[model samples]
Target: MLNYRLFGDLSSSAAPLVVLHGLLGSLDNWHTFARGQAGKRTVLAIDLRNHGDSPHVAGMSYRQMVDDVVAVLDTLAIPECYLMGHSMGGKVAMMLALQHPSRVRRLLVVDIAPKAYPPRHQALLHAMVGMPLGELSSRKQADEWLSATVKHPFERGFLLKNLGRKTEGQFYWQCNLPEIARHYLKISGFPTTDAVYPAPTLFIRGGQSDYVADTDLPMIRQAFPAAELVTVAAAGHLPHVQTPAEFTVLVEAFLG
Candidate 1:
């Protein structure tokens, strides 16, 4: 079972909002956003399988991830709620809305399309798997070592989120590196589902991100006929981080 750490007041009167983190991310990534939505709605931030405190499963397929979310929602007795996700999480949210329409009242996808991404993330995953954990001294040292293997600083930081040190001074990864490394391809690919969720869907695109290019709109529309697109200017893959105010405004309007 996937362990999910929730936030905010679950007993709030407003409709619940479940936020799923991206690849290599945990519920902590959505702390600010979840806090902003507090009182207005109950925010349930999930740490997907193999990330954060979640259990490591044998497979990393979207179907398996969706099942994890379903289990959490059912356990919470949340009848229907708003679904929001970013990058990998966006794909999961898309699948959940498609396969389990009754569970999602509103769908919000951030900076990703309904297409398969290239295996470009393989190098980063490889570097993570190859990290010299035994010799790693501190997080700064790990950062310096990872800098030699990974070029993109932001991406390196994202991967570094998994690095942790034991009380005995031995370093390890908080994430299940072997599973993520072995299933990199599956993680980048979206599942093929014939089900189309016609619920009012919102696609929040990052202006600087190529993840959701104009060319992908056709596929998005083909699957989600009622979906609408909104772009956050001067933002990249994680718009909520770059432009939280704008992202919040857009989300509030969409949820209304």
Candidate 2:
């Protein structure tokens, strides 16, 4: 089962809010958002397969990831919940809602359209997978080396979250980097399903992010006809992280 963190009461009268992180992200990345929502309802932050503390499996298919989450929900006895996700996780949420509409009472997708994206992270994946973990003695060294390919401080730090220490004290990547690289195209592509999720849904995008283009709206509307779109002007790619207060407000308003 996928590793997950649950907050709020198990018997909370409200359906839980299940949050899924983006590519190269773990449950820890959504701590702020989950905590903010947990105050009013149960919140489940899950580490998708091959990321974070979850098992490092070979495939990264949205179907597989969706099932992984379903397995966790089944284990926890959560019949349905307010589901949300960011980027790649957004795709998973979209798939889950479409594949299992009864399990999602409401849906919130962040910064991703229900269409395929080109393979943009291959170079970065290769860089991370090809890192000399055996020679790196410190996280600082890893950061310095990664800086060669990943220049932005924030993104570099975010990617470094995958670094884990072996029992012998050597640094290793906890995320299944090699397999992610191999299935980069699959990850970029959306799942093959003509099914649409006819539920009250909200799509939040970062004004500074190009991940969700205006051109993608028709397709998004087609798949999620009940979807409402919102943009956080001050944020880019990661509005929940960049503007937590504003994002939290939007989420709460939607849930209500």
Candidate 3:
């Protein structure tokens, strides 16, 4: 089963919200957003296979990832849930709602559209895999090393979260980088399906991020016809992190 963290009251009458994070991210990434909305309803943020504290095996396909999520929901005894995901996770959420519409009460996709994207993470993943983990004594050195390819401090720090130190004084990546690298192509494309989800849906895009464009909406509406697209004008790829208050308002208004 996939690893999961819970937020808010379990006894709350509202249906639980299941959150998934982006590529190279873990459930920890959603901690701030989950905590902020904890009082309103329960939030179950999950670590997709090969991410965070979840068990890592081989497959990284969206279908396999969706199966992993379905298994988690079954294990938790949650028949239905409000679903949300960011970036790569957003694609997973879209696939889940498309495949199992009855299990999702509402869907929220952050900063991504339900379509195939060109492979853009090749350099980043290569830099990470080629990093000298053994020679790195501190995160500072690792950051400096990665700075050759990853210039932005925000992205550098985010990816570095998967780096961990063992009790024996050895550092290792917490995520399955090799597996992710191996299936990067599969992760970039979405599954072709004629399925459509008719439930309430929200698609929030970071205005500064070109991940989702106005041109993608007609195609997005084709899959999630009920989807309402909104732009977080001041934010980039991570709207929730860049502008928490505004993000919260949008989430609350949509879920309510």
Scored by lDDT, the top model is 3
The candidate, 2 or 3, that scores higher on TM-score is 3
Candidate 3, overall lDDT?
0.93
Q: Rate the local accuracy (lDDT) of all candidates.
A: 0.87, 0.91, 0.93
Better of 1 and 2 by lDDT: 2
lDDT of 2 by residue, 1-256 (tens): 8899987767756788999999999999889777776467888999999899899888889999999999998998999999999999999999999999999999999999988888888878888988999999899999998888998999999999999998798998888888888888999999777898999999999999999988888889888999989999999999999999999899999999
Off by over 4 Å in 3: none
Instruction: For each candidate in turn, give its C-alpha RMSD to the true structure in angstroms.
Output: 1.3, 1.1, 0.9
* Ten residues in sequence with the least summed lDDT for candidate 3: 6-15
**Backbone clashes in model 3:** 0
Off by over 4 Å in 2: none
Q: Per-residue alpha-carbon lDDT of model 3 for 152-227, expressed as tens digits?
A: 9998999999999999888899999999999999999999999999999999999899999999989999989998
TM accuracy, model 2: 0.97
Q: Model 1 off-target regions past 4 Å?
A: none
